[model samples]
Target chain A: MNFDDTPEQARLRAEVRQFLAAHHDELAHGDGAYLEEPGHERVDELRRTQAVLFDAGYMGLTWPEEYGGGGGTNAQQAVINEELHRARVAGPVGHVGLGMCGPTILRHGSEDQKQRYIRRLLRADDMWCQLFSEPGGGSDLAALRTKATRHDDGWHVQGQKVWTTLAQHCRFGILLARTNPEAARHRGLTMFVIDMEAPGVTVRPLRQMNGHHSFNEVFLDDVVIADSERLGDVDDGWRVALTTLMNERMAVGGGGGELGVRSDVLVSHANRLLPRLSEERRVLAVEALGRVLVESLAARYSGYRLQTTLEKGEHPGPESSAGKLTAVRVAHATADLGLRLLGEDAVLARSRDGDWRWASAAASTPGIALAGGTDEILRNIVGERVLGLPPDRPRTPAAATATPIAESR
Target chain B: MDFDIDDEQRNFAQHARDFFSEQAGPEHARTLLAAPGEAAPGRRVLAELGFSSLTIPEDFGGVGAELLNMALVAEQAGRQLAGPSLTTAARVAVLLADDADRLAAFSEGRLSLAVLDGPPSGSRPSMDVVGATHFLALDGDDLVIGEGRVTLGEPIDATRGLGYVELTSSEVVAQDAQARWARARQVACVILAAEGLGAADRAVEIGLEYAKTRETFGRQIGAYQAVKHRLVDDWVAVNQLRSLVWWAAWAADHAPDQLPIAASAAKAYCAGTFETACETLIHVLGGIGFTWEHDAHLYWRRAKVDRLLLGDESEHLAAVATCTLHAADAAATGELQPI
Candidate 1:
């Protein structure tokens, strides 16, 4: 298997290197991919940085040129991501819009939706959040009770969605709601692009154990939506959602650099920290290092394999989901090990007095496992799709009997 | 750039599986063990199939192929638990190729070296030594090929016997013994790791197949998330195992400088994967898996034997850490030469 970069790809990588070198000072701090900051400020910073990347033609290199993308290949995208990962750039913006929502819209959105959303999303003009999982719907996502009864004007939506990442900053969302109660579980839903600022819409931040607020519970109390906002046909939301979900796997699977952090960094950290640790803890650290290294190498190359397939103009399919599964585990485990190795200073968000600031800052890593898809869901997908195993029994969803959300927790 | 083997290797693997399945496989392992210590039939098939000469150069009367082709044979052997590895001779033959007589004899299928499990133990046990004229051992940094004075014992895995070879009068095959040891060790790692991958693949298949029929709580076990997730993870591990095996085997032939770390990583990873998979196969097989009569133990036996055969998982992982981290640290400091 040849993984050598083509000359053109090498040239592009050099260009990206030069770009990052030039912008190193400005990008040394946070990229704000999370939602801890004010929505307006986050959006502003994202727009500015994204505008620079857009002008540099590094944004959406793999997307077709019609959507303001560079119309390059997945290899280019992989190179760009590798550079971005090396630079440790997070952002005040969410990648969901560009990676998931935008692609789904481009494939399924009406002409108006495509023209209105693709360019803006690519330019990071507006952050987007997904409103698919409801308070009652996680693993059994199709059993969501969010109702979108038909209105004379359009549809009046009433639902509460949980784990709505970036909803506090999002101007728009792809919302899934039950449109036909009489239809089968997966056949009765519809997808809509709801304005987060629409009347009766509310977003309440969910502060996590990481002490960060990256997720939100969104309440839709009779939120009115125009029929034009609908994505795909009525009762065809499952197909549209499938596109987003598949793209979500690709995004997460091929996400950043495989290991979130480099082995050199971990090695250097060990070289620095091991001297001060006790014998028992030193052994523990080595064990963790072994796990981290195995996972990092696997994830890094798995991502490359996915890119190879993507460069061949094929979707990553079920195999790529393993990347996300492995990555989320690695990211969280490394973070946990970092905090434990921090001795007494683990309570603080990070150390200004020490070197594991990045690791300590990984407090937010647990969120990654749930985002895109839960670990169990991904495992099931890998089992059923990749291994050709039988799907879980098609029993009715446990949440199918839940009462409609009354702004429930 | 593809991460998969070429179509030729894939086809060869199918042929190997077909041949071994028909003649010598896990079933063959049992039948062969009934006669214990009689490795003639297996050795004969290997010679006829040219498996023993896969790595020897054409000048020495061999197929003169690379480790990738050898890996296909090893993988199919592991998949079916088919006989002892003939890749052993192919490995040491390439390393000791300067010994023209030994190389010629091995290439002509008249000579073989029973490779030993060279842990730090003083009394190391050799394997597959039934009809071999010489025994090879790696003692510390020394590469010794023994000629006389051997002690035999019952093997942990009955398919192969164990023996101790005296190295005091053995030949020093190379002046740079450490270098030779490292080279042969990496190539051997490739072949064995591929076998581990095959075993893992087979374990996953066995588990999934059993899960489809074995019922618990009035439902097929495969329908349960507990069983299904374990099999899924096993499948994932098998994929990782294959990837690493391919990389190691590829590196052994094309990137020798990178082979040390690649092979160590493959060994470290595969050793664990194979053991875990074989254990899981027994778990999935339930009561019968524990019975000596069931075939599950044979795979488990081979997996356990293969793991500790070269070096245990921990030892290999230590090597992985040393080789990889040192290389990484060197690259970071601009000390490493380009691969």
Candidate 2:
């Protein structure tokens, strides 16, 4: 087993480094936080930055060239990812368009849909957001209430989606709606591509505790989508949705600073704060930081394992769940250390000081757990899928009837 | 770059696992627990499998495989709760690379060896040393090889023998061996951590298997989130340690500059993770787990001993913390690239 990249991979990494150095000003900075901008200027900047990567052929390193991908090896793709991560710049697009939606479409979309969407998606000519999670269904996504009815003209979609990221800026959405309510919960759902600016579609930003509006509450009031836009089969949405969900785990498992703060950032924070801390506090801080460093390294090495699997052309198993969970756990621990070091500065949310970055990171971590999957759900996935443990039995009507009596008692 | 062992090493590990299962599996370990006076019961089989010469030089009539191959077999050895024969022989063979006669005898299973590592003074505990012929030890910055008087300690995890030794006659094989000792300790940490990982992996599997079949309150206990999540967390810890172990072994072979920090991280992390895995196994097994008939305690004892074998978790963590800060300092000055 080896840790160092091969000569070819090293060359790819160097080329990426040279490209980033030459085009740093044109790319998204601070790990793509600027891409979350709520204005037209940010959209324009995103397109420009994405065009740079698309032009450089850095986008879609492992995707087929027929679909505007680089048609490269997974190791080469991993090298590009590592370089991008080291440069602390978000890649060509966010997780929604590049990581999740594009991959789903490439796999399950019709030939026409692939021809129409994949290139634009990769080029950021059209931004995308996922419209799967509903107000009533966050972790239980298959239980969504969104209804898409058949019509001669198209399908009319009516449902409310909460936590729709970048909905206001996205040109399209990869949506999951109930197509056959008479069918089983998972079997009845279908995946669709709906225009975000279509009539009767409204996007309202949700203010987070961190005071960011990165998420939204999207309302679809009888919005019409053409029949050709539907992805996968009529009732095969769950399978297609699985494709996206799998990619979501992989995307989040990569553990860029955009999802949550990286551990190296916390190490730097600890180093900067250690001298000012009292000797007693310093000991506690170091101990806490040690655990973070260890787990962070674990998360990283876990990513390497996943990359190895990909290189061998095997589908990653529940290792992604473990990786995402470990990343979130590291984020929580890193944030806790940040708050402890800040003491009073943690509460000063609007401060312009460097200490507030840690505070911001702490505040934003809850969203990380909510994204892709919650902590409990991922643990259940790991338990059942990875460990081969029996899954939690679904609650039956009889059990629900008895629950009222137990609650009253 | 691959982060996994090659197919040959993988097949060898599988062969080792099969050999241990038929020869020195948990049942055999239980018998050893019943009789702590037994020397390394699997020593002859271990040498037969050629694990004894995994890292020794080819000139010494050994396989001359790298450290990672030794680590892969060490993991399998840990899984079956085999004796410390593999650990002691692998370590001693590398430290005595210059002694062709001893190396050949060691490779041929004529020279039984035990190893001791500590601050290099007074008495230090060595495992599986009840009937070994020679003892290799560290003595205040010097590496020593000699005959020693062994006083057997009461067996806590009796899958292997444990004893403290006082060297009667010895020679300083290497003077001022601080750097070599550190490297040797790092190698030990990697091997022990790999062993702990193997044990931890088996313990979790056992727990998971029992959870699937063992029923409580009219349902399989695994169906309950509390039990399932605990098992899942333990499984995650196992993965964490597995990655660290692979990286540590790889670093030892291919990236010596990264070995010290990588091994410390693996040792520190594996100590806690392995214990958690064994504890989770016992908890999942419920009452039967606490009984002597159960193999859970064997793993528990192994974890407890391995945690303190070279240094405990906190000591290794301190080393990790120091390295972390130094790396950060160097990165700030652009002396080293931050990973």
Candidate 3:
């Protein structure tokens, strides 16, 4: 298992560093630390920086050049990501579109869909959200009751999707709905590219505990999606949705964690408290740091391990589930340590000097347990797909299982 | 570039697993535990398959393989959970990049080596010492190999073959033995961690099977979140252990700079992961797991011994912490520069 990048990869990384150096002011020094899911203004700032990245061919390093990418190896993509993360910039906007929706369209969408959607998505000219989960069924997404009746012109969809991030601003979404209710749950679904601005479609911002309004509850009432917008065959939505969700899992799992979830904060915090810490506390704090460090390393390396599998041209397999689970667990651990160390001040929001990152990371981690795939569902996926354990009963694979990290090889 | 095991390594690991499963597996463990004795058969198998000389340089008439190869096999040994001892690892390490002519003798089944690592002043229990003809003692800063008169002592891990050796005369193999000792320490950690990973993998596998088959509250216990989540944690740990073990093994070879830090991390992390795996398996197994006849306790006992065998988790963890602090200080003081 090699950790050092090859010379070619190193050269590419140097080039990327040079690119970032040229664009540092626009990328890293734009404003206060950008959140993972930034506000519209921050996203607009991110788009400008991402446009710089796109022009330099760092934005879509591994995607085919025909689709507005560099056509580079997966190693280059990994390097670009490492350099970007090292620079502390919020990554490009429209990650859902690029990582999940764009890839899914490239795979399952018709030729016209590819010609229309892929380049714009990669350039962050448009935004996309997943319209999969409903208020009735979440972890059990296959059991969703949204209706999509077939029409001569298109499919008329009526569904409510909760936890739809960026829907308030997105012009389009990947929607999953039941096209044939008489069939079995897994087989009766269809996937569509629904225009968010279409008639009878309404998006309401969901206020988070942290007072962030990034998540939205999207309501669809007979939303007429044109025939050209259908992603896959009617009543085969589960299969196409699986494609999108697989991309979603890898994007979420390997994308690292949300805002305020950086492990560095906790590490630096412990370092600061060390000189004054009592002997017992010193040992305790170091042990906790070591544990969290191990978890973080494990999560990071799990992504690398999965990347090797991608390089081998196989499906994402089970490690993404493990990655997702471990990522959130580490975030939770960071929060736990943050609270214990800060004591009464831990609950204070927007503390002086912006100490709220820790408290906010802790407060926002629960959303992770719900996002991507819920903890319980992810555990089941790991158990069944990764560990070869017998499922509670034989059925379709989890929505987030079997994706191959947005590339065929 | 790659973090996952290569196809060749995977095949090697598979072969090791098959050998252990067919030969020195749970049945073998039961046989040894019934009488509480040494694993002489396991020793013969190790020598027969050239596992004893895996890392011996080609000039010494051995495979000249790296630590990663050893880690793959060692992990399988742990998975089979029925090895006689990990003594082969120390012998391999002492002879790794060595000028010695011991590989042929070892591969030909003429010599068996036991590596005892601890303080040299006092007598401490040793492993891989049962019926061995050679001994390598890793004292604090000195590495010495000796032909010794020894007496065996009973150990909690009956298979480890713990004993004491009195080296009347010894040859100092390396004067500046720090590098050699570090390699030994790191490779040993990787081997044991591979074993830990093996134990973790099996314990979790057994627990998951039980969870699927065992019924409680009129349904399979695996249906319950409580049981399912425990197994998932074990599975996650196994992956973590697998990742670190591979990394530590890799560091032992190509990246000498990372060996100390990586080995400490591996040793520190694997100990708890292995221990938790056993305990959680027992939890999953319930009453049947508590019985003397059940195999869970054997792994649990091994985990207990392995955790403290190389100074406990916190000690190695402190090493990791110290390294981090030193690096940080070095950076601040300009003692070290970024690569």
The TM-score of predicted model 3 comes to 0.90
RMSD of each: 3.6, 3.6, 5.0
In angstroms, give how far residue A165 of model 3 lies from its true place.
0.9
Tens digits of lDDT, candidate 3, A162-216: 9898788788889998887666667778888988888999999998876677789
- Candidate 1 per-residue lDDT over residues A248-353, each given as its tens digit: 8877754424334445555656556667899887766666666666666666655666666677788757777777887777676655665666677666665656
- lDDT, candidates in the order shown: 0.73, 0.79, 0.73
A380 in model 3: Cα distance from truth in Å?
1.5
Using lDDT, rank the candidates from best to worst.
2, 3, 1
> Which ranking of candidates, highest DockQ first?
2, 1, 3
Worst 10 residues of 2 chain B by lDDT: B116-125
Q: Give interface RMSD, per candidate.
A: 2.1, 1.2, 2.1
Flag the better candidate by DockQ, 1 or 2: 2
lDDT of 2 by residue, B150-251 (tens): 887777777656777877778888788777767877888888888889999999999999999999898899989999998899888888888898888888
What are the per-residue Cα lDDT tens digits for candidate 2 across A230-311?
A: 9999989999998888888888764322355656677777777789888888877777777778887888887787778788
